[model samples]
Target: MSAPAVGKRQDRSGPGTSRLLAVHLRIADVLLRLVQLHALWLGWTLRGGLVLGVFPATAAVAAIARRDALGRTAEGSWGELRRDFARHWRGQFRHANALGWILAAAGALILIEERVMRAAGDGAIGVFVAGVLWMLGAGVAALGVLVWPLAAHFDARPLAVIRGAVVLLLGRPLAALAPLGAAAALAAAYYLVPGLIPAFGVAGPLWLVTAVLLRGGALPAAPAAAPEPR
Candidate 1:
């Protein structure tokens, strides 16, 4: 009753069916949170918040995923969501920009290489560039699913977070594909019904990626608390 007194810690290991139910419940919560995040992203984006606000908003979504994974959040808690979003947005602003620049640069290189390959129209260098572009795209996908969660869950330098994500991907290539596969599916769904984004855009993909990372033990488990004074 009363939602377990809000912050009272409980055993995380539940029965198999309970765990399955919880997963489903979490997905429902994520869909709600996704609407909130998409609204924030849209509001900020409309104000020319592209470079300045995108990462912070994205970080907020990642923060929600992290908090929910740790069992520190409750459903229908808008105040908590706002607080978490603001905290993550401020803490991650600079790092988000750093990541944005890196991704932007990679995208530019891919476009430039594509143009060169088009102009060359079949050559060894063209083929090589195409391969490089493919690899870069793959790397970007890995970075997207890993980096924000890394930032949300750890207190590390931005570059360190990037390196850790890369290391994790290299060490567990198959597991790493979870996020990329989720991304591709989400992208396809969005392409098919562009309206789906307004309804369940980032949250769907974020939850999918976060679920994968949690399963892989990429995030540290929340520590159990000491017993309250009796």
Candidate 2:
């Protein structure tokens, strides 16, 4: 009787140990994926020469992250993911750059406005104008934060992508917070660790955005078809 009881206990322990090991393996797998995705993002960004590369690289990562969040690519191997990401980056390069540069120009305009406001000196009217400019800057940043994910998930023109982002910002404002918070947290972490910037920095926030949008029903029922440059 004692021997059988010992065997039963061992069997129970075996399953528990297996479960724990499985959990650890799953975590390791996820971390490895993030690292690989980050590497791809960095490589592609540098390939584009940073200025021109950043947006398309971002779109590629966003697309991959969206697929992963939807479980469409959950079982995809790293090679498959890399291939898909490259396709996205190349296909969307022109459109992504157009979208990105437009936002960049807007950001520059906002900065110019801020400088002008500062030159106006500290007065009641100047203070009021400064507050309005700050709000405008925040709105532009929010649009930017939402736009790449929209572009990745939608096969639309840059203008349409901007409109979609606007609709999402107006309609599901609360849902937007998840990705923004993720971005803020990642920034804080990178500030502290620095090394993580190259590993999980961009991929981490984009993945969170993709996941948040998917869970909140912000994405279409079906993934957008691969877009072609027009």
Which predicted model would earn the best lDDT?
Answer: 2
> lDDT by residue for model 1 over 1-230, one digit each (tens)?
66775434343434666989999996776676778777765654444367687776676677777766666665566666666566667766777778756766777777787777878876887788788878887787668677877777766667787887888789877767777687778989999999988887676687668766775665557533311111
> How far off is residue 95 in model 2, in Å?
1.2
| Tens-digit lDDT string for candidate 2 (1-230) | 89999999999999999999999997887678789889999999999999989999988888887777777665767787777878889988999899999888988998898889899799998889889989888888888888888887778899898888888888887777777776778778889999887788688878877777777777774764745333
TM-score of 1: 0.76
**lDDT accuracy of residue 170 in candidate 1:** 91
Give the C-alpha lDDT of model 1. Answer: 0.70
The 10-residue segment of model 2 with minimum total lDDT is 221-230
- Point out where model 1 deviates above 4 Å: 1-27, 45-48, 222-230
The reply for model 2, stretches above 4 Å from the true place, is 1-16, 74-80, 221-230
User: What is the C-alpha local distance difference test score of each model?
Assistant: 0.70, 0.83
Candidate 2: C-alpha RMSD after superposition: 2.6
RMSD of each: 9.3, 2.6
Evaluate model 2: give its lDDT: 0.83
